[model samples]
Target: MLIREATEADWPVIWPFFHDITAAGETFTYPFDLGRDEARGWWLLPPPDRTVVAVDEAGTVLGTAKMNANHHGNGAHVASASYMVDPAHRHRGVGRALCEHTLQWAREQGYRAMQFNAVVETNLPAVALYRSLGFEVLGTLPEGFRHPRHGYVGLHIMHRAL
Candidate 1:
């Protein structure tokens, strides 16, 4: 698989997976009905931030990640990132690769730490992957998410120093 910077042309391939993943209510906190324009702006950030995608040998997008500063001004040294893998491509390490790439990019951009602000507690695979990659659970918000199936679930704040 090839991991590369995402282009505007890649949105068509990313939208379906982004829509479905957000709608699933299993991981992300985004509204299931989030509009296209907002999603586009969120994914394709300007300047300092970067977005990337993982594609198979055939160029089918398998996953993606967007990374940027966790906050502004004095807090700018901390970075944050979000990731999504096509459900059909789960268990294939796409998420891992995207994360690895994102981290490297964050370091190159001079970030001192990386954080995930709202990781769903029940998303074990993702949580585990983050853990394996050196992220530690900083805290958890009780009943932070209204999971469609699991009712109320905790949202974790995971962080790693660069």
Candidate 2:
């Protein structure tokens, strides 16, 4: 798979998968029916954010990620990121590669650590990946996310020193 920085034109291809994942309301805390323009503004090109896409040999987007600061001022040295893979492309190492690339990019940009503030506790695969990548479950906020089907689930705060 090829991993590269995303450009403006890539949003059209990225949006459908984004919409599908967010609509599922299984992992992210975003509103289930979040609008396209709002998603574009948040995930595509927001300031202090860098979006990237992973594609196969034929250029089919397998997944996407957005990396940015976890917070402001004193917390800006710690990077934060989000990932989404097309359901059809699951279990092919796309998410792993994207996470690795994001870590590398963050460190290259001088970030001291990487934090994921709200990882749904039900997303075992993602939790496992982060663990394998050396992230620790700093803590979990009880009933932090309201999953559509499994309401009142916990949210994990995961972090890894860069």
Candidate 3:
């Protein structure tokens, strides 16, 4: 698979799965009814922030990741990121590859560490992946996320030093 910076033209390809994922309300905290324009504004970040997509040999987008400083000014040294893998392409290492790529990018950009602010506790696959990649569960906010089927679930704050 090829992982590279995403271009504006890629948005159309990305939005379908992005909308599906967010609407599922299984992982991401984005509003279920989030509109295209608002989603675009959030995903297609500019400048010091970076976004990338992973594609197969046929050039089909398999997954995407966005990375940026977790906060500005005093907290700028730490980075944060989000990832989404096409449902049709799950369990094929696409998410892992996207994560590895994002980590490399973060290191290259001089980030001191990376933090995930609101990882859903029930998203076991992602939480496991992050732990395997050296992230630690810093803490969990009790019943922080309202999962569609699971009622209120904990939100994990995970961290890793770059």
Which candidate should be chosen as best, given lDDT against the real structure? 3
Residue 15 in candidate 3, Cα distance off native in Å: 0.4
For all candidates in order, the CA lDDT equals 0.93, 0.92, 0.95
Predictions ranked by lDDT, top down? 3, 1, 2
Task: For residues 1-162, write the lDDT of model 1, one tens digit per residue.
Answer: 899889999998899989998988789888889887789898988778888899999999999999999999999999999999998999999999999998999999999999999999999999999999999999999999999999999999999999
lDDT of 3 at 62: 97
TM-score of each: 0.97, 0.96, 0.99
- Global lDDT for candidate 2? 0.92
What is the Cα-based lDDT of residue 124 in candidate 2? 95
Q: Report the poorest 10 consecutive residues by lDDT, candidate 3.
A: 39-48
Candidate 1 — which pairs collide? none
- Off by more than 4 A, model 2: 46-48
Model 1 residue runs over 4 Å out of place are none
Supply every candidate's count of residue pairs whose N, Cα or C atoms clash at under 3 angstroms.
0, 0, 0
